[model samples]
Target: MLAVIRERYRAHGFDEIETPVMEEYSRLHAGIGGDNEKLAYNVLKRGLDADAIRGAAGDPAALTDLGLRYDLTVPLARFYATNRGQLPSVFRSIQIAPVWRAERPQKGRYRQFVQCDIDIIGDASARAEAELAVATLDTLDALGLEGGSIRINDRRVLDWMLDSFGFTSDERPGVLITIDKLDKLGPDGIVAELRERGATAGAVDAFAAFLRRPTTLEYNPYGERQIRKALPDGAPDDIVAHLVGIGAAVAASRGSATELEGDIPLVFDPFLVRGMGYYTGTIFELAHPSVDYSLGGGGRYDGMIGRFLGQDVPAVGFSIGFERIVDLVSERTDAAAPAVVLVHDRDVPEGELLALKAALVREGSRVRLEQRTKNLKALLERAASDGYTAFATVAQGTTPASLEVKPLA
Candidate 1:
């Protein structure tokens, strides 16, 4: 799964970069939330001596000084920090690697999984965000995933709504965390949950009502409230009209008759509430009608690299959950068993065997020659039992120079 995705991104002009699995504990804590940091697996150092190793076995937590990578994006930022001068102005990369998270293993979630990520750095425009959507659509199309919609929203818009209701930055994460559940728990359920969490009734009700309202906001280069202020009373009809116009523009530009809108559905779902703190402008999720959880998601993070470089380098990207994609592909397509052919040519000249193998390969047959030499009848029987379509005999061709090809059936 990771290899396929990595190749696809690489073909699309992305350079493959690798980051250290073992990171300094302080470096790993940069910008990540408390819960995410807690999920990291600390790389504990064991003492060299046998006695020390045995003594430290009972209290191994004290010996750890580093942590495994929680996600690839942060480490990429760190890499950019050290090697920024050596990199190009507009950077594109794909990282397909394992990340560890100490979470209770459940459906679609795991302790260790591979994240297939593609990111473009050093740009700050709505078109960059739109390209994230386009790349995501392209990737899913390549994978043959069906009935998935890319839901999009801006974190700035969410921030505006939160601040408009008098919520501070400190309160914003918690509020966004709950509002993240507006879909799972309906308005009433969310209101109840907020109240249970000790939010005032007015704040909860106002927040709930605001969230339940039309999610489409005018993509204001300035801000959402300013866009509303330009309009009379910030009517939902006007906001929706702006959204429809922008969404249409997005569709017309990215979606031709082929890449999207037929098997893979792309819709403007403004209600998508991606809870990552790093996302700045546009955030999105890919949801399937058959699967309850999102297949994967990503968004724009303009400030992420800024924190590391001391200068803002806008970027947008997404990670595909490779395991989920494999499962989906397995369920969606009828899989065929591969044919295996065992070869008994260990003592035979290598060049002759390779030539025989190449001849069969050129005929468009899925032929694999096993190198182990065994009794000819046993090899033939095993090849038949292993579901081979055909078998070939490669030898010195003494007396007769012609080749013998036998159907396994």
Candidate 2:
């Protein structure tokens, strides 16, 4: 699977690079990563005076200057900024590596896990978004996953929705954080949580009603009408156009042989508020019917790099949740049996045994060499249990001659 991901990403002209796992603590807490900042594993300051460390023990910030990265995107942003002159004007990058988070571990959620990401920095066109969506869907299709869907929503559209619902600018972030949990907490649960967070009952009721509306897909005139009605009279035209353009692009790409199209639905989901604080434009998630959680997600973050470089650099990225995809794929695929196992008598020459192993490997077979034991039957039984399908036994009298081979029962 990793090989397939590398091939797909490289085929799209994305150069694979790696960044350090630990970043400066201040860089990790730049207010763009949302909840992930709180989950960073802070590294304690080294080579400091013992007295100073004891004095700053109450305030960890003074003692910590580094932290384990929570995602690949932020580190990429920093990398691009520092290496801008060395990279192409429009940089497409692939980073497949592990990130750390100080979070509770669950079935598919872990503190340490690999993230498969492909990001295009310095491209502001909606085409970037379209290409990313298509490439990601194609990759999933190549992996034999079906009946999945990509639920897309623009952050501007979400902002408009919040404004239409009378949520103040100050209330927006808190409200968005609550809305992000809608999948786990149903509509009623969301409203209850909102009210608990000091939102007015009227606002909560209105938001709840809006959430109850059925999900809208592209090219649905009625759905567009609903969106228009829900948005303010003067909602930004560019945001609306960008949203329409993405939907059209995705719909058109569905016809291509590379994409799964009808089998994997791509629809507009107005209520999706991805938890990331950096998302500035279109946001999306890939989900499969068989999986309860999202398979992966990403979006545009136009302003993030500007924080470091003092100039805006448009970026869009998509990351597949490596652990979740692996889990699903593992469940669907059959375990492969070993090609062959080599059994040699105790008196068999070591040189002959090595020669036999090399010959089998040259034949493109996976071969394992084991010394014969008094419990020969038990050894073979164990090898069979370990998934070896065939066995070859070396004759004691042969230096580099014939051997006996048998298939496991």
Candidate 3:
């Protein structure tokens, strides 16, 4: 599974890099507030008892602790800082590894799940943002997602709307958080939550209306195809406009068919609050009807690296939820791991077995050889019953020079 995802990123010109799973507490906190920050699993060294560490701080507020990385992006930024000289001017990297979060496990969400992240750093161009979206789309496309669309929004656009409404700093956070729940709770639910949270009725109504309407292509060709046949062509373009515009910019820059004009669908959505403070520019989420969970999502954070580097460096990325993708792909396709059959013939001496195994391995084949008292015919039958793709004989007519290989199917 890791290899499949790694190949996808590598084909897109992303360098595969390894970063430590354990990170400093400060580096791990990317200001993605609310339950996100609390979800990180903190680490304490062995021999340092939890009670002692808690007591060492004296005051509850001043403990500098370490934590297992909550996500790959934060540690990737740290990696860039540490290896500034060795890395390329424009760093495009991919990491596939386990990330720990303390969130409640439910449905497809887990405390220990693999997050496949692809990021581009040091370039603030809209091209970076578009490329990130395209890469994410391509990854899903490879996984056989035929009916989903990539919904995108810009944090700048969201902030613009909030500031335009004259929301107070204290009020904006709650409002944005509630507005983020537009999908689950619906417009009416958001209005109620906002009203309870002290937002003016007018503000809540306007916010709900804004979310319901989004920008898009001039003709409702795609919208009609998606929502219904009776919807008007001039339906609000709020979300569609933003996504199509970014996608256009990306297409104009890269000249790739996967851009705005490409067949890969792009949907605009104002209510896509990605639940991260680090996102500064374009944001996106991938959704498909086959699965309820997001395949994975990410966006551009222009000055995110500057928060650590002192000088601003633009960055954009998207993470592919390996488990979600695997789940979706499994449902739609018959792709499964290849099986290897162990071929052991008692006629072959044990001394020459190692050479035969090595030769098969050198040919890029998966081989399994274990001692078995059963005859070759029974072994082959068992291999077939077990769904092995190919079978190999340990010894061929008492000559140990080569393996007897044949396709099981």
Candidate 4:
């Protein structure tokens, strides 16, 4: 799955780049990571004496110099800022690596997992967004994932919409938190949550009025009318138009037989407030019906780079939750380069086996040499499960030319 995603990203002109698994503790906690910051694993500072350790209670972060990265985007921001002069004005990078998060162990949640991410730096325009969405959809299709769709929204639009609703600046954050729960809590639950949180009475009442309207937000793939219906009158036209353009561009590029809608696979979700607080503009989540959770998500963070580089750079990224998607994607079945196993009797000389295996390896075959065991059937079944497509039996007198390879049943 990683290979397919990485190569698909590379094929789309995204250069594969690697960042250190550990970054400065301060960088990880710089508030951009959203809730992930609290989950980062801090590496204890070396050689802390009893007094130093005792003093650290006052400033726990001071006790750690570096920490495991919770996600790739924050590290990528630092990487771009450091390497900006040497990189292209519009840099496309692919990061597929493990990230650590200290989560309470549960099904589908782990302390460690892999993330497959592709980010575009330096292009703030919708083109960067379009490229990311298209590339991600293409990569999903390449992974044989069906019924994938992208849910998109803009933070700026959320702000504008909130302002229009009379939500004070102080009330917006808590309001967004409640809004993010719309799918889980429903319209009535959202209103209840806001009221429980003591949101300004007028704002909560106004929002509830909109939610209870007859033209409630319904799920659709994408369109101007669909978007307008989702929001009250006078939603920002520029942001609305930008989202419409993104949907059109991605739809025109997709050739899926399993599109979410009859036409496109992009959903303009006006309330998609992704968890990341750094997201300044467009935010999106990739969804598939097989799972209730999103497969992945990302958004534009035009201000993050400037915090480190002293100048802001336009950037956006999309990531695939590899641990979640791995189970969803079955082993690839491409027969172009099938794996072969050499089942050999103990009598076969190591030199002869090596010569045969080396020959097969040079000919572009993944050759695994397994000694014949008593449970031949079980061995063959295991090999089949491991993705070995064909096998050949070899013994003392066997030669490469004389080998008979048969497809595994």
Which candidate should be chosen as best, given TM-score against the real structure? 4
Please give the CA lDDT of all the candidate structures.
0.67, 0.81, 0.69, 0.88
Candidate 3: tens digits of C-alpha lDDT, residues 212-264: 67756555422224332222233335534544556666555445554424444
The prediction achieving the highest lDDT against the true structure is 4
State each candidate's clash count.
0, 0, 14, 0
- Candidate 2 versus the native: TM-score? 0.86
Model 4: per-residue Cα lDDT over 1-409, one tens digit each: 7788988999998998899999998898888888889889999999999999998877868799899999998899999999989999999999999999999989789999999999999887777888899898889989899779889889998999889888999988889999999999999999999999998889888988988887535565577877888888988888888777777666556654333445787788888998887999999999998889999999999999999999888989999889888888877656878689999999899999999999888878888999999999999999999999999999897888998989998
Candidate 1's displacement at residue 10, Å, is: 3.6
* lDDT (C-alpha) at residue 52 in model 4: 90
Candidate 2 residues 1-409, lDDT tens each?
8988888878767899999999998889989999999999999888899999989989868999999999998899999999999999999999999999988998877999999999999889877888888778778877778667778788988887787778888888999888888878988899989999997667787888776767555454312443455454666778767765665566667663322333326666777888888999889998988978899999999999998899999999999988888867642323353468888778877787888888777766678888888998898899877767788878666543465667877
Better of 1 and 2 by lDDT: 2
Model 3: runs farther than 4 Å from truth?
A: 30-34, 45-64, 146-148, 208-245, 249-264, 331-340, 345-348, 373-387, 392-397, 400-409
Query: How well does candidate 1 score on lDDT at residue 176?
Result: 70
Ranking by lDDT: 4, 2, 3, 1
**Residue 330 lDDT in candidate 3:** 48
